[model samples]
Target chain A: MNYPNKKKSFQKEVNKANLGMTLESDIDATNRYYLDSGIAVIHKKPTPIQVVNVSYPARNKAKITEAYYKTPSTTDYNGVFKGKYIDFDAKETNSTTSFPLKNIHPHQISHLTSVEKQNGIAFFIIHFKPYNEYYILPIHLLMPLWENQYKEKGRKSIPYAYFKDNLHQIHFSYQPRLDYLKVIQTVFNF
Target chain B: MNYPNKKKSFQKEVNKANLGMTLESDIDATNRYYLDSGIAVIHKKPTPIQVVNVSYPARNKAKITEAYYKTPSTTDYNGVFKGKYIDFDAKETNSTTSFPLKNIHPHQISHLTSVEKQNGIAFFIIHFKPYNEYYILPIHLLMPLWENQYKEKGRKSIPYAYFKDNLHQIHFSYQPRLDYLKVIQTVFNF
Candidate 1:
């Protein structure tokens, strides 16, 4: 959402093959690493899209003529880790003072809350691009901030200090890139 | 994949609103029913696709001009159930005698096996459309059959009697149509 344009320093030219890939790819690479080593079976769900119209240009070639991106029913990333069901989303923001709430949809919050109710480990991997900081913000911390949106006592964004103090810091690594699962191990004792 | 034509009487015109919807919708509806009742948190991953070209016909409108479906990296459906991770695919075969091995891709078997190594529940929901029957086939039974495809001991498709006797039966319901999770209770003991 607003996070991409908020940080000019984080912008970089990406290869054409990864047209729609973003912070999600970094997380995917980490997931792939986890999967290959038999550490976890995690994956990023494909972007849900609704193709309204299509045309057959050739015998086996179909060309999409009309389509629209559909809001997904669940968060982006989900899988199993150490027999625990893990569900989460990864986001990047440039805001130094606070991470905007708009980056997450109301449906996604409710969906994660449902997963939490089922006792699945649910959280968000928030990256402050300006500082190159990544933190595992659990659902427990997200709920209050999200609920505050409907009440008067809540601020519009989560402050950087709140992340620094309450959230688990995820270190950057070369192979796994953002090893948020390592943070999960420390926080959830996996 | 050939199951739909195996039985002719099972064929029926699906409503147009479900343009690309397959037998998987019944599973999705079942998942939604489970989610709404706090019974489980399951979802069918969107079909993966590669968007090649797009045109901005208007200021607020964008149309996809070229796209192709990409093979999914994992199964079509997965989620948390009673705190246990569940991963699977749903198939409808009209065949009364043998279910084709071609319905499932080799990589899916590999993906599910990886999930199984992590102690997650992995299986398939195959509907014998002709008999109007559904069965929850566990990964243990699937692995041998999938592996047999590469060896002399395996047949091309699983026999219908094998499903009727070996796999757990999933009855059709008015509310939770497929109710495959119901069978998960007996097999996984969750």
Candidate 2:
């Protein structure tokens, strides 16, 4: 599938925005809009920042250069919709067949496990490469794949056919490119 | 109280470890340790990355620069704790008496408000400068002060006395520098 062209144009649209929003930013804004409109209460988790050396450019301004990425200990996003705790990760894959397990870390899978154990609604919004097709895969389905991969019996990536059949399709709208709450509503009645 | 003069000693410690762990990294490690041990479920959120350009040093390696900070749309940390969703911000302040409201954006406060409304647990881990004393101030308490700050009679920071009396004090331990779950346990019995 020729996904690069469509993905590039989508990237261009995001870059052309005055705010220069990224895919994550757009999703966040859309989530906030959804929250404000009383559609849902969801939020992206903040990136962990480790400020090592801060140069004071001014009294009120500080510049940070020396920093390292910290391993996140929880899922990317979580909140409540109609009294149900919603949890999920927003991931974009360039592969047409499946998202590579490498895109997800063991810690994230564990976090999802914890969320599921707590009876919270957990899933992932995966964007297929070149084709802008987005699908919502439940955490339960992901865990077994992750386990099988770890055990050396599963493929490194989930086939696109599996995604098409098992996952719920999330429609992209002007307001929320990956408006996933609608799928959540269908799955959890929230 | 004046903080101990440990700059030279701490720098020596930093050099001896050969680990360029930032304060954020240390916090993340601590949270991970706690989670792995089943002590608590907490995570530092992923930073919002706006990757405008990516340089491929190697086919598998991509170095990102020329990116800007995207306005965060959610709280920094959140997870499940004994059937409740825990959410909060870990802020370091160099003030002695009070924490500045300016440290938190209006949108973040709104996010916390929404979390509180959903029956999830939300609070802030405020680190007092020099003293290193940390306190967990609930969102419910912070909201009113945040709102009243614009009434022409509002204080810029929450006084230490208010924190001491109302907020739960979190002790800095070796495992979890800002071990706040203990406070949560006391407050919510979880």
The residue-by-residue lDDT of candidate 2 on A1-190, one tens digit each, is 7434655655665654533235577678878787878766787666564444544443333345344445576666777665567788877776777788888877778777777776778788787746778788888888778778766566788888898877788877787666787887797654
Error of 1 at A128 (Å): 0.8
How do the predictions measure up, each by TM-score? 0.88, 0.68
Interface RMSD in angstroms for candidate 2: 3.5
- Complex DockQ, candidate 1: 0.70
- Per model, the share of native interface contacts recovered reads 0.85, 0.23
**Candidate 2 — which residues are off by over 4 angstroms?**
A1-29, A44-76, A80-85, A91-107, A127-134, A149-167, A171-179, A185-190, B1-29, B46-59, B64-71, B92-97, B129-132, B188-190
Chain A vs native chain A, TM-score per candidate: 0.85, 0.80
User: Which pairs in model 1 have colliding backbones?
Assistant: B3-B93, B3-B94, B7-B94
Off by over 4 Å in 1: A1-22, B1-22
What does the lDDT come to for candidate 1? 0.82
The residue-level lDDT of candidate 1 at B2 comes to 44
Residue A129 lDDT, candidate 2, scale 0-100: 48
Can you give the DockQ of every candidate in the order shown? 0.70, 0.25
The top-ranked prediction according to lDDT is 1
